[model samples]
Target: MKATTTSAIVLAGGLGTRLRSAVPDLPKPMAPVAGRPFLAHLLDRWIDQGITHFVLSVGYRHEVIRAYFGGTYGGATLDYAVEATPQGTGGGLLLAAQHLPADAPFLLLNGDTFFDVPLSQLTELAASQQTDWCFALFRTSEPGRYMGMEIAQDSRITNLRTGMEQPERLANGGVYIVHPRSLSGLAAQPDTPLSLENDLFPRLLAAGQRWFGLECPGAFIDIGIPQDFHRAASVLPVHTAQRTEDALHH
Candidate 1:
């Protein structure tokens, strides 16, 4: 991998249905925070991580992101994969991957979420001879509201458990380093809706391929629902969602 390859694919296509009550007129990432669109801060985080290029996958009201950010963001080149229909996370990712280089591993971040983990570290892991997919794991008390994940002692993900009844578990941090070749199966067929947590990760895990998760302890938050959206509006101006653990049970 070249040191200059700081490209990333941002999954920004989600409709943000749950957040509509709070940001009814705009896309989730376009929601106002600190007098700017929430995505601006996210782009700042990625740009700070040495990412020089971005391929944003956008659907519902994508023009909002385009009109606001236009072609450049924080010194990084901005591009978009405008989805005419609503594709799930994985499909959106696949669409955006076409815009990235075939040989380089790309960082993936949820547009509506921010986790203060080092993006370079994830890419470092991905550059290894064996690493294919790498993810950041965050401990959350409200695992039910997010995707529950389990990583073994060797850092191999054993399972991504779902539902609200499970014990204290690490939630998917919505940050990843993914290789375009690693997702060939999903990329081959487009528009069929696939999810990173519910679909892609499972197939990767079952295949016994090389994938690992870094234990990233720092500010982590997803403005996916109204409760967290309100909480973020207050906390984001002064701090990123840094916590030892989130015990608030969403």
Candidate 2:
């Protein structure tokens, strides 16, 4: 699929309870990484890949994000989906389903995590897999704090971790390529907040559905906590260099 045809859904509706000390007044997406909001850097990279449409899932202090980004940032068309009540990752994506194209696959990323994977490569892999979903995987030196996935020798995601099992294996980098058909039954239960990691992924695995994972080699950063936020800000140049290299290759 062409980059212009693939829409992006940014899951920005999190409450950011962990990083509230540094960014108490704004949503996580609007929190400053270096001098500008983190979303600015994310959008810049996405635009390099030819993505033009964006659906931002906003919740707490959502007005802050809206006021700053408005309808469009740079050349990307932006749309907002407000979650009156807090929802998990899967729920937030479901809420923004209306803004996505039914025939084309879309990219989804967490507002708090940053990685340097080539979006076009991921898109091509998703199209080739002919599967429901594909996620970007990061092999962290310390996978003790994140969800893990066990992939078969063929690179198919055979299993996913939950509860105590998550910290024991490779971590899940918060990026995904999702087909609209993969989310067919998500909205059936509206009241409960279902997690894409905890609830949805395992179910997909049980049903014998194939999900692909792309192991990224570029720098990965998670700005959900104060320490991580500081580390990411300090390493902004490194991230920029990796992104630039990836763009040139693409």
Q: Could you say which candidate leads in lDDT?
A: 1
lDDT of 2 by residue, 153-225 (tens): 7667887764333334556788888888877665824578868777777777788776888887767888898
lDDT of 1 at 156: 69
Name the Cα RMSD for model 2. Answer: 5.0
Looking at model 1, residue 108 earns an lDDT score of 86
What are the per-residue Cα lDDT tens digits for candidate 1 across 75-150?
Answer: 7889999887777887888889989878777788899998888766666666763467788888877636877777
- Pick out the ten consecutive residues of candidate 2 with the lowest summed lDDT: 241-250
How well does each candidate superpose onto the true structure, as a TM-score? 0.88, 0.88
Q: Candidates' lDDT values, in order?
A: 0.77, 0.77
How far does residue 233 in candidate 1 sit from its true spot (Å)?
A: 3.9
